[model samples]
Target chain A: MSTTVVNTGTEGKTWGGGNEPLKASYGKMMMWFFIVSDALTFSGFLAAYGFSRFKFIESWPIADEVFTHVPFLHGQELPMIYVAFMTFILIMSSVTMVLAVDAGHKMNKTKVTWYMFLTIIGGLIFVGSQAWEWATFIKGDYGAVQTKGGNILQFVDTDGHRVALGDFVVAEHKDRTAHERKNGLWFVDEGTLPTYTVDEVIKGLESHENVLVRTQIINEEGEKTVLSRAESLKQIKENGKAVVEGANLYVNEYGSPLFADFFFFITGFHGFHVFSGVVINIIIFFNVILGTYEKRKSYEMVEKVGLYWHFVDLVWVFVFTFFYLV
Target chain B: MGHEHKLEILRGLIKFKSNTQKIWGVLILLSIVTAVEVVLGIYKPEALMTQVLSMKLLNWIFIILTIVKAYYITWDFMHMRDETKALRRMVVWTAVFLICYLVFILLQEGGYIEGVYSSGFVKRDF
Candidate 1:
């Protein structure tokens, strides 16, 4: 509300001093401002993600295919199951937060403490689940090829199942220098490696008569660029490995490496927020147990935390829709 | 200093009335709207789909419904509905402007980056 200029030509005054723009409680008003700024930050991240998805509109990886892992259900494809669980947990925590605030109103210390504890536990569970989701995404599954045309061609079986590059690729024509005890000019020692090098796969393909190179795109109809059985065998030999490393933001065998980069950065940033929220919730949980707010004669602190908690849930709603559902 | 008045006021505010029941009715209606959004999100309709939207029409449904849910959250759950007009305007307007600003800028820049990436200059050796 605007204040009319008085006889003294003064505006509304805050408790501490005059001329404060916002005429509200210091902490509460500040919290609203902070939420506003934070919401923008999240929007920026999501917008970047949208841009990338638009760029690779034709060949972007499907969200369901990428995030199909479920907890304790090993090898089962459970698309968005984990994230859905996290959403439910956060929503339940919001309910607990409201209960704690209600208990605070009645001055019921035991109920407040218990409700706060439940909310804290819910937050922790959500953070842990998110961490697991991140781990699965970072590790990746069913690699693809980065073509010279900047398109990603992923391998799939005749049945339309995603085939690991390791399953179908065979390498041919690998050229490696003989291990010289020392190089004449560079005098550098051979770099040690963990597994067989790409050169080895190539060499192995060259020496072996059974493998061949198969190159073509697999369409959504579960059809591949057709090849005879003999040709398929020949292609496998030249390809060396059935699977090739796929792209992530760090490294992706996809269109632009930016896809993985945005995935990690945007989702990682949101995950960081959830993590911090949990820590703050833990502090509040301890305070509730200690009866700190009980002595203060108000459960307003719980309500404030509840506001923050719900904000996180609100953000996730958008994230899930944009990232997965879309 | 005014303990009697304070207690009476608190009691009055917390009391259940037909008015409170109406509010609950409104909440249920909002919840139904949310449910419809969820259903549309899950079952994407082919006929309603449009690529220009950058997402499925079903997804647009979800987004619109989510905004509605957000409105109820701030208005009813957070008690913004009862606040003075100035306070309500400050809260809603600030969020609306910033969110729109961020969305516009990010999408434009992101599209630019995507164009650069699609070009042959950068090799994606995934």
Candidate 2:
């Protein structure tokens, strides 16, 4: 038996096979579709974050106070400066990425290579900055106490300036031993203990006449509620349960646990995207150097990856606004 | 393949000589917007602190500027403006519509939950 091929005589039409309806190649169209889906995923994360913030609008952590540290500048309360620098770095990298794509469009190999190199360098700097920011956040500057009601109570001087527990807490040698697998249950071990005990903090508060307690709840003037000296002593002595040093999933000295959770989750996800974008750029960079695109007579690969890189930057713009600015 | 780039931005108010120039121009615009945002955030002018439609005026400004930055990044840097109208709408309209709906529903629900928490019916705090 024999088989014969059939053609519908519409092979070159818009709806026919191999027709470019959107005037985009299969790879580019697929990239656009992927980007749309990815945008939705990011939006879901951001919307959830917004929901949580709305829920705790009265007691949310102040972004400025939390992101005050800059590299090599200890004890300086310069808020929004470091984050602004990170934003500039990401935006600059995005600019370089588009430059690389433009050079690729012209099939200028030297220009493409140089722009790609700059873009990769910018990405590395942004990632490094993010890591440093995470470190500063996790190793909190001024420790606070977590009350039984899950609220944070921070110490402040009479003038409303924050006071660190390390400034006043007197350490007592009380033979406090860490629980280990060898000494305790075979499968159980305790997490790292806080720097100071709640009782120690209370005793320090009692001795420090100028110190007051500030609750997480925002008052009429849109600031954390600072209680009077007698009220501060009463609140801390009665309700304070644990000393919180830094941020984590369960506890954060930065007012709300949800804030830290979203901070880690959202920024971590975006950082992962930046990292993968850099890796892909490196691969494309090597391919350009090897004359792969020159031989293929098309540098659309660079354009495709450039779209992804710009998308990463776009997400960061929103993240920076929502996480830090708003 | 060589394709012509749309060189003008800001509704034809500004034009660039080439695609590279346009990229730099958009970068400058974005940087300026970010700087303004940082200044407002740091200073938090007392006038902008007034609540408008349940949000601070400063927050509104930041969100609008952020959207402006996103638009330029997509239209210029991603070359969305060069694409066909169908493709642009397919990518943009879908995300925008869905995200707005999701945010609306979630925020409303969050507000309701907050009311419940604060109304003394649910004792969340000790």
Candidate 3:
């Protein structure tokens, strides 16, 4: 073997094996790879959501009608406003994150610290807003009745305004109560009972002259099919099986149970991403304060984390579109 | 550590002085898109409700706008534009192709399942 080393003349070129072929550091390139994989994971979830929505195309709930509540604005039907605000908050955080990266490039520690702080604040606000939205979704506004065939039956007045079950439901004195493990079965316990029973809803429907039943089925005009008064009474008395309040994996006062499942799963997943992003930001934030990057003379760490943060915001844009707007 | 950014957006129709400025510009564009989406969602114009390619025109607009927002968030916010061409292609092309395939297959399957639900022994209508 020759003592002289062979030269391929590929060193420092774009195709060089170890010379940063992508013009990105190992850590930053790995971050991009992670982000791409994560993007596919989110797309899987969203496509599953699309599958379910298309499966129940005719009976799917309208997002505008479902997500109408706003913070501190009770009894008002303002749709899409609160969600729009949340989108703005996430986008603003993303902007601050990129600014932090820009500051990192310039080795401006103070600017990076402040911008990172602002980005963290924006993320916290977004997570908090999402929690509020989830709470409201769980504690649903207007309760609906579930038919034996697993369909939602909502109450509406003559003017097509939704009427809450609480407005007209009259509780009848009954000895029946929720089944508890201590009360009956030693190993089985039932879920919390809804406030009102199906019979009570039927009774209220009979007494209320203006209230009518709206089926989950959509008509030609893309509205829920409202039954005639007589048909409404017959439907409730004969088919109504239980009163459903709020949303759960099994039951939803919305049109389909699948809708609630997807909402909880997809948004819950994205919220987890936001939460982890905040935690990572906090860790890097402390490092910045301690002059870790200042000593290293490179803020590439900040740029890597910024990529993750921006990925979270990107996912949210799609989530907001598929969940709310579309 | 000489990191340079391509600071022009909208096919170089708009240019910015610095990375910070570019971020703000992208933010403004995203916010405007979101505002337009919110307004359309709230109003739900009848003209846009008409079906096009088996979907409502309004939905098509929303999806297109969402893609646009995603583009800016990736290209600008994530600094994909400044990265090497190989890196950008590796991330963007893989994601776009796989997502489109997944969505197409799932949606088609869902429509088929709906047909089965309606026409099969298990009747959906009560």
Candidate 4:
């Protein structure tokens, strides 16, 4: 028997990506390549967020204060508890993913299936919790007025408890005619009006003698600055420019509008990653049940997808730290 | 593939006979690290909050701990430690250098803009 081997003159060199010079499988290396580039994309977003946040560091909303809501336990100020739970779920999912990869390596189909199921469940819970958190943030708890200086003016009683606009502001509706297309102002629809107007806010402040205004600027004590009764009246009467009921791209009851923008963008981006990860995992889960990898005699597909799942979890670790902890 | 299957961690301080056990070990280690982070974030010890190197000491701790978590997730969960040195460096170095560079430039420019705003030249709030 004669065996002839031909060398294409490019052997023993790392010019082409075919030779496995780094001893990594092609698919694994590609996953790493995608991860590195995806990592840079995430870094860009987080860095820009950091820039805007540093610009208004003094008045930047404290993350602990902003992400204080928990589902089903309304009106309770449980800061970081739900987020911590979400973090734990995600980490546990990563653990399950790695375990699945390990089972795949051992050629244990049953264990791999169970671990994948667990990972998928964990991911679903985290995404659901994130959606609930987003809703709570959008609805907002306390309404605020935007000062002409672009700072937020929150209301509080003498006891320092936050007062919602609905609790004190008794706004009288003006009988203004609505703009209609038939009236020759087709493109001139009025913007959705806020629940209360600036005048209504000032009137409410004047009526509630016990209520004072709290500025967004954090004082030396690490709390928002509270103005005295007379100062509140003067500032609101002079500087109140717009009534902001809740959060949107332009206005945020929490404080800085940039906070809302970054919050929405970064978390939304991460949520998208989780969503896709879930979809991919579901596909892989179905394939695993069909014995697809078993027919191939190698579970490298499971391992490759496991790499992506872990990377997503890794990114979330940083997001949780920067967005919540830092 | 000439697999290097010596499953050891922490510079060979601990070795696992099975990959599953190793995964659990890494998971426990990561969980402890996260627990410490959550505690520090919740309590935020006042003593550790004193400014150091233009930032709070606790913030530095948070960043350091986050890096540690990232390292374990990559090296252990992703099997980077078992990978060849070239592949490891290729992925890790690319990400590390780019992220550091981007953060440095952005934060520097941001600080400059902040100074401009606070120097009484631009009236943003009024």
* Candidate with the greatest DockQ versus the true structure: 2
What TM-score fits each model?
A: 0.72, 0.98, 0.96, 0.93
Local distance difference test scores for all models: 0.61, 0.92, 0.93, 0.87
For residues A1-326, what per-residue lDDT tens digits would candidate 3 score against the true structure? 69787777897776766766677788998998999899999999999999999898989999988999999999899999999999999999998999999999999999999999999999999999999999999999999999999999999999999999999999888788989989898898889899999989988998899999999988889889999999999999988998999998999998799999999999999999999999999999999999999999999899999999999999999999999998
- The best-first sequence of candidates by TM-score reads 2, 3, 4, 1
Q: Report the C-alpha displacement of residue A323, candidate 3, in angstroms.
A: 0.7
For model 2, residues A1-326, the per-residue Cα lDDT tens digits are: 25655777888787778766688888998998999999999999999999998888888998988999889997899999999999999999998889888888888999999999999999999999999999889989899999998999999999999999999898788678788899979999787898899899999999999999999988889889999999999999999999999898889998999999999999999999999999999999999999999999899999999999999999999999999999
Off by over 4 Å in 2: A1-3
Q: List model 4 lDDT by residue over B1-126, tens digit each.
A: 343455888888999987788888888888899999988988988899788987889999999999999998999998998898999999999899999999999988888888888897888764
lDDT of 4 by residue, A234-274 (tens): 98888989888768788899899999998899889998999
Question: Residue-wise lDDT of candidate 2 within B33-123, one digit each (tens)?
Answer: 9999999999999999898999999999999999999999999999999999999999999989999999999999888888888888888
What value does the lDDT take at residue B84 in candidate 3?
85
lDDT per residue (tens digit) for residues A1-326 in model 1: 36774445343445434643544456656676677788878887887677666655545655666777888898787676676667667666766776676566677889888988888788888878877877766565655543444444444454445655454335444455545556554665543221334444444434434433324333443123434445544444444332336444545543346767877777778778878877887888788888898788776677677767777877876787777766
Model 4: lDDT of residue A33: 97
The true-versus-predicted C-alpha distance at residue A19 of model 3, in Å, is 2.0
- Candidate 4 interface RMSD (Å): 1.2
Kindly report which residue stretches of model 4 are placed more than 4 angstroms away from their true locations once superposed. A1-18, A174-192, B1-6
